[model samples]
Target chain A: MSYITGPDVVKYACSCGLLKPISHLYFCRYCFQLRCSFCVCHEVDSNFCGKCSENIPSSEARVKKNRCGNCYVCPSCQQELSTRIASKGPVNPEDSKSTPKKMYYLSCQFCRWSSRDVGIPDQSTVTGGWPERENVHSNRLQELVDMYKAIVLAQKQQKDKDKKKQRGKFLSYTDRTGVTAAALRKRIGLPAEFTHPILKNKPKEPEPASAKTEVDEVPEQLLTEPINLMEITTVEQRLLQPEAQPVTVDKLFPVHKQLSIKRSLRCRHCEHNVSKPEYNPSSVKFKIQLFAYYHIPEIRIVTVEPLRAGKQCELIVKFTNPTQHQTTIAFLKLNMDEEDASLDSEVAEVIQDLDQTLSLQEKQQMSLTSLPLSTSQPSSLISVPSRQPSLTIEPRKISQEVNCDIEVPTSSFILPPRDDAAEYDDSGDTHNIQDDPKLVKWRKSNKAFIKLNVTPMSDLALNSEVVCGFIMQHIYTNTVASKEPQKYNHKVKVFLRLGQLVGSE
Target chain B: MSRNNIKILPGALVCEESKLRGDITIGSGTIVHPSATIIAEAGPIIIGECCLIEEQVKIIHRLPFDQQNKENTTPVLIIGSHNVFEVDCTVESPKIGNNNVFESKCYVGNKVTVSNGCIIGAGCRVTEEQILKENIIIFGSKCQMREGLDRPGLQTLQMETLSKMIPNYHHIKKPNKKV
Candidate 1:
């Protein structure tokens, strides 16, 4: 139960050499590998306001600057402000027929701040039409953005012309007939040149922005007057209103609540979604969720005797087969050097082909030189395919240390598949199986506890924690059925933080 | 609206619909609105003058678990003058000083000692055993504490208006003796 919220004492080494708990790892069925958040690609799925739970389309969210249209947060405390009604008594107290008029205003119940306190008038409607402040420099910024876009487009056109010149293969009659036509027109006594219709209608280039020399001077009162910390806005408060960034508290306006986004994870190697959430923000269901906890066998420390330096202690660990098929657990010596040597041998075979594809010169010849694009036409008119992100994650060697030694058992144990009905049935020992009493201590329907001898390192400081690790090799049966239903050995390095060592014997 | 085991001093305006139970004493000039409940489970309670207890406000006097084993003595909850308990607030504080304001929907646990001019903001659950400093205001979702430059002003106008309007709508619990 503590494993859910407490610190992760047991960790599994990911394929990318990062150590993480089982909950943080996702199983990619196509690649048959465990992928962590660092190895997977994240994409925004939807944007919605958490306060009102209203789904805002991505395009509308962009137009609203990723903020909710109707919701607002308090400028002082950032809490959601609720609309409250204030009843104003009748205008004429002497008139018996006059009725009270109600008005609405935004108020932060937590901070006791009312819109009236800030001199904002109450509206006649419940959802008050709050005045929104616009960016003062919006026009200037828009001009700058337009200028940059034009400059970029012009530079792109220039590059296109250069590329066309490099090709120089298009033999248009205009170039060859210019001199011949002039001589022919001279022989006939007529004008040789006629303006092309397309060139006359070309768009005019946009003017560039000019740098300004004058700037605003600092106010002289800032030097003499003592600053009031309460009245002055902090950096965080100013940043909340990115457009205005008011320095005084009086200028602080209610900010629209920022929208939250749901993210979907995709495996980089297979381009398959490892986890994808539903489109609706209110629903917490997932469309695709391939968690490693469901695919791999889970190991837990059941109990361990008091650990003393240089003394062997009995450590009992339970293994549960989460899959529908039975699995055999084998304990191997935690030898990373041997694994690295095997990986090097495999890499030696593929390095030649990898080197050929990794060369920049070869890539350039294959991409640009052979396939020449028609430069006479507008490049924007041609819709080129978007570039796909290539998988570039390289596997790294495991970097970890083990201070305690675990006595490897000679025999391996088998765990039965998990059965939901087994929980209710009182009848036990339905399946007759032979087990080694030395290695297997206790057995349940889907779980089994195995005993091992562990010894902490001697000559160590007192009260130091004992850490140990092992290479767990389990027989995995692939149920994907893409190929033959075959059994394979899947190995993962498991590290555990054992209890602290007592005084040396 | 239990009349037994309750005392309302002269000039105290307590609505007839207000629920009063156990040993409780209302001071002079204090106003307790309808639906306000005052329950003294551990011992008697003594409220000072000019305090305003709003609708649905609950004032409970219950001893803490740690203090239950002490020598058997009747503990007293003393609330100072001019304190305001806003709507739907529950205050179990054993000691409260003058000019303290417990905002709407806020909860003060049995271990908190609220001093003068302290404002417990709305929806704040201050269960941690500690003493609140004078002129301190706790607000926000994070329960941030800020020192106010001055004490909050008394709701004199609202109290006066309520005093004038409430007598016309409901019955008032009269003081048993004249001062």
Candidate 2:
């Protein structure tokens, strides 16, 4: 089965309340919990252009407004525009030797839109000096932004001043002596100097924006003339060019290509990276990828009998062990009533560890993913403020229904470790092991076909889909470097969507 | 019916490898690259001067099913001058005007009529039964139409260079007419 784009008939309940396919889930080894995209923190790692595949530094991308400098997208069809050259006729007709001058213009081969359509002159150079449009309200927006920034800075300074006043009970030596720098200088027969703090000289306050009472009147032509659908820009097109979203077709200009970003996902509980892509934009590799598909056994439906309502049907499913270690699988009842005590303990441990990591004696404030400490904080502070302990997000309840009952087998089965060379070997079944014929149907290298019996509910309607869920408790051998290979029982809730029920027999 | 029926005017550069069928006439200053095919199934075909038919281009002039049974009378397919059939382009259009460009991998159906200064963009297919107006460009996924400001300029330098270099490596079809 193609898991990448295939319809997900098999899904696993993530640590969060969300239910997702196994391919989308990540297994955090330290915390031993299934993490999904919703449970992880996504952060931008790098920015690059999709057209040229050139990596743009984050700082440079910020300066360029997160757009490629040389590449342009068509304003009409949003396709990448290529530079086309036009050869001009020689200026001096008498001189046959004079070469024709070449001019470049941005043109889209897909939509046949060119810079000349908008009355932009062709440039003499290949990389055309295309004119950039400035936002008409940029000046007013800048003033507003400055005013807000100044207001925030003033509020922060006021808060700091309140904190300093609270700490003023422990007076300084100069205050205790009732002698300032000027008083001490006069007593020592020296020149006087002012003892006022630097904060006494206030910075200039930014002017706030003024709101006008009168609004601009609607144009008269809008009421009389019929609107042309082709000339008017769509909502998506306007959002693409946020600076000057021209309403008319002729006012549309080529936009610089937006840069793409590589994202790194961090596990929310343990703060470990579940998946971290390489910094180089061209490299499609990951530094840390803890996918659940690699750790947990993969289940694929091999064959199933025609399902009928209120009838037991034979279902054969194959399980593949992708890990290097051999594991044992057992069938457990899909019970949603019991809370997983181990999951609760793991979260509590993570919170305690986080508390120890962010001690008030050292780092008073901590950010996620081990972000660097604030650079604006001075090192001379003797006492650190104590903050509240970090709260842990509790594991959500498993919200799923098992309409069908799967007969749990008594005996467990053993799956051999994966061996790459065994695939090429024509010799079959070298390892002789006892297997219950009813439980295990067939066996191969690192793969086994197990038969199951399922009964749909009697009240299921005709042509209604039958879903069956089970708690698969498999023996997981952790191969951490610090400890010996330890085998632990891990339970994963899996749901399988069976075919529609047929007529009652 | 025979290769002897093909006529090449003076200054025309028709490569020997080009596949020509039926009564075909090539005008002066026309360059037909090797592997270009022209089939005049309906009748005689006349190509005008300064036309460039690049390699792998196919020009077919077939009569409609109703008129196929009419004997002793054959319709003529006339392609105007300064038209360029780019590489791998297939044109079954009944008529083509001057300064028209059928870009690379473009396909123009028999029902379509291409007028002056029209450009069928690369990989575009025009199978609809309609006439393209002058300087109209058809491109993009939706086949959006737009008016061109000016006609595409002729590749005189490339034509001059190809005329001098093609005859050295491959056999050339000699001119049968002085005009």
Candidate 3:
């Protein structure tokens, strides 16, 4: 016999007629139908840490009280204390300085609360924990419990009355049907089929005369109930009692304890011995093992020069990939304030093109040219003039198939001579000789354009070598243009380099 | 109504000197107090009972700017029950919720979410689509909070330090799990 699979299940509308995905739809066990967030009542059952077995509800987790039923705080400083394992021996070799017994330290930095003041034997050890305080007055406890029950019953009665008043105002059609059926049965001298069992047992009663007035004044009905002192006593007693406290051991420590081998290596050439550094390679190894396969691309600004208003400048961005797998750089877009038009248009074009190409490897260098400048300066930029120009690079999209190398050229340019005097000198006789001296200077500067050629690096990791060429051109043309045309040229080369470690094993 | 006969709903707490205009439906256990003005200019202000409207609470369904035109009316202020509106609270837009609390001097702008069991602290201003989670407590004055509580403490200095150590640490810290 062949097994037959049904057609792909179409997510029909919920019982409440809400069209949602199968994932969004939840099976209402009570209603036996699909329910969405809107249809069913969402009641938080418990607030529990998935790792630990500790759980507490929102009402019990009061900020002012600061006492969780399962967690203990140092009474003095209110810092959460953890449980530690300890051996019972005066001179246990395992409990020596080299191998100290595990102890819980409930120390608060704010108030310096320590667990030592709580009279627990060995503050560091979990043995002889804080003594449990028990109430010897059993009779009082029983009386208080009885009083609480009575208060609850009275409160419930008041609530029922208020609900009845509200229900009376509704005037449902079922009530009319019930009345008509009862009257017809009485006229025919037959039993009423629809009459409820509970109602059948009760004698017929006349309707209240002030039913309308009662319904109208439902809100006031709740306030008429008298407060019971017995209920308050139980509530106060519960609030005053110290809550139960539990110990929490860090789970990570147990997993890390198994791999606690401390190994050291020495280099013979330098006659230098390398002990275990503060930054353990094993820890880095563990992180790599955990997240190397699933790493996301991150873009950051390595360095930025002086931000020019309404002028174009180059930005050097450094991209780092900690994962083993290579990441393709699809597009590196920037989000500037909408008001800044200088970089908007030019940067958009450059990013759009870069997005089409560029696939960067793990720990690779990629640099792009022609970064757009922001026309309108940010308020912070204007106030802090000395601050370097910063650009936020957002990798718009990422891919794995396509990759392109980013070439950042580092070079300086010298402006060419700007002279139109020699060519127009032959026609000087026909033209006005008293031309504005400023006008002549203006024409000279306009004719000049800077040229630059970058020297590519053979080894990208060479830090001592100059990777970028910068030139600040000061045009001394005595031009009478409406505004002085001041231009600046700066170039930057972005590449990845291994940072130095003070001490490494 | 007699002073003793004024039924204060389960969660409803009203502050002093508050004036309520027109027919307002407060749900069970709702409280409203002195000096707070809940005005239903165009439509009724239906607040689910059990909501706590703290001292000096001001809920205006219609903007004072819209009063110029007779035809153009304001939206109704529909608040759900079990909400705590703290002292000096001002809600402009109609907000709906249960078990939510707005701390002192909170300014909830137009069209925001004060979701279930959220505690908004004193002097906070919510302007955008701020979706607070259940049992979430925001403490501070004038926070530009955003939607999605999954990324808690993203804009804080602590997160910045982590980002400095490991680039894109937030993306790696927790798996993308949506509640």
Candidate 4:
């Protein structure tokens, strides 16, 4: 649990070369590689109002400028404003039998800011139609937008005509003849040109705004009067109403709460979704979550002896196999300077070529594999041809320097597959696999305690932090696309902080 | 550090489930939720009228290290009227003023003096020695301070509803004072 907010004492180098906790990395089953956020394609899966939890369509969200219409945040505190109802007494005492009328206004529980403070009228109904501001220069801006659209259209058409002229090696029958297309159109009682009438003439340009040379003089009252800091608005308060940027606090208005989006991450190499959340705004579950924690063997630092410069220390680490299939864990010498991950790029290229042919087969296999995935994805979330394919981020050299050398043991260890029933069954582990007594200090059901010898560099300064690292090669069982399980070697570089080196006693 | 000497004024609803130690005074119309602790280790604690202390809230009045062995000059920690101490907050402030709010899970150290209409926001820890000005709001994890134009609105509605609902379910300590 401390890994969420604690120091990064243990880090795994992501395929993209970024050092991240194992929980933050995602495992791509198809590519058999770890993908971090940097190496994944992020797409907005859905937009929803955080307050009301109402899903908004992309078109509606665009039109509404991605803000919830009903939910308002306090301009002062930036907290969600709740609508409160106040009851009014009956106007006539004789008719006291009538129920009181209810009026609603927005209020902030944190800052005590209310809509009434800004002179906004209370509404009788709960869903009050809050007043919205229109930009004073919107009409002029609209004219400019339309004019640019027309200009772009004319430019595009001109380019198309030039392209046609260049490619027209063999003249058309009409062009070769004594008649042109325009002349034929006129002869057929149609318009001489099919171009837009606006395009026929140059696009109208809006009147340019002129600046005044003279500026308004500051009021004399400001120089003479003592200022009240309480009356003036702070930078944060003014920024909330960016359109107005009112200096006075009374002019601040409640702003609509911005919409939040759920994002789905896709693996760049395989072009497959690595993580996708469920469509419901309230549900925290994901439809496809390929977090590396579920597949990789987790390592936690159990204990380590006080490190002295050039002195050997015993370091203990606990490893747990999270997968359903047993895996063989091997330690490889850590290489900080170069990476063999570039070889994966060539492999990815081959997969990319296969993906092109796989799509055609996928269309055929769509009905057969309907139960698992890709059948329930929303149209908005589908990968479109217009969007460019995500490029894989280049792996970087592991940045942390290893000050301590870890002795790599020659023997590999076997981790039993995780069993859900083993914890409650109370029955001892029945596995017959033999473990190296010197390497493996303890073994339980699915977890093993491994001991390693580490030594801090002799040249390291006194009290300097000592870092040690090694590459872990594990057997990954791939069961996604085959009737029988296919296994492969997956290498992951892990670094550990083994506390600081002390001077020799 | 002393025997319990609780004095509840008339109209004050002090739940019997709450823990009160040493000398303490609960003013009229004050509501103390069950499980709230008011410890007066150094001296007596005088909570004013209409104050609301919610569950898991701890109001401790222990003396500072330097003052622990010294003769106490002002032995009473006076909390003002209409103040609200929300859930799970720990307040050891020597001085607290009227209309102030100590939000949920916040910690007000002994050195801090909370003035009138001030608010210590949720989860904020203010251990540094400083006097909070009127209407000052200390918020966020960094304990950033911002001045507000007005104090937070009273929790009268919530307090009114609680005063009616609490006595029906839990045992009530009888008011020992008329006012």
Of candidate 4 chain A, the 10-residue stretch with the lowest lDDT total is A367-376
Which candidate wins on DockQ?
2
In lDDT terms, how accurate is model 1?
0.78
Q: Model 2, A1-505: lDDT tens per residue?
A: 5754277878888877577888989988755677899888899988999888889999999999899999999987788999999888886878999999888999887767789988999899887778888789888787777766776776788789878887877756787887776878888989786534434443454466579999999999999999856567666567778788787767779999999999998876557789999887778899999999988888878888888888999999888898899888998877777665443332222223213333443332323211111121232332332322122455577776778889988888998888999989998878776889998999999999999999999899889888898877776766652244655567788888888888966
lDDT of each: 0.78, 0.80, 0.38, 0.83
True contacts recovered per prediction: 0.35, 0.53, 0.00, 0.06
Model 1 per-residue lDDT at A426: 95
Q: What are the chain A TM-scores for all the models, listed individually?
A: 0.72, 0.76, 0.24, 0.79
Clashing pairs in 2: A110-B140
lDDT winner: 4
> Tens digits of per-residue lDDT for model 4 on A59-100?
999999899988999887789999999877775667979888
Listed in order, each prediction's TM-score against the native is: 0.66, 0.67, 0.22, 0.80
lDDT of 1 by residue, A1-505 (tens): 6555256777887767788878788877645567899889999989999888889999999999899999999876777889988888887989978988888988776665567666788888887789887789888787777766766776677778778786897775746767665567667878767444333333453455678899789988899899766567667778888889888777778889999998899987557899999988888889999888887788788798888888889999888888888888888888766643342222112223223333554344323211112122333343432322235355576776678888988889899988888999898857665888999998999889989899888765678888788877776666563343445566677887787888755
The digit string of per-residue lDDT tens for model 3 on A392-499 reads 222122111111122222332122232345356664323222323321221121121112222223333222322232211121221112133211111111122112
Error in Å for residue B82 of model 2: 11
Model 3 / residue A420 / CA error / Å: 86
DockQ values of all predictions: 0.24, 0.31, 0.01, 0.24
What is the CAPRI rating of model 4's predicted complex?
acceptable
Model 2, B1-179: lDDT tens per residue? Answer: 44437899999999999999989999999999999999987778899999999999999997656667988766788999989999999998888899998889999998888889998888888998899888887766556566676787787888899899999999999998876
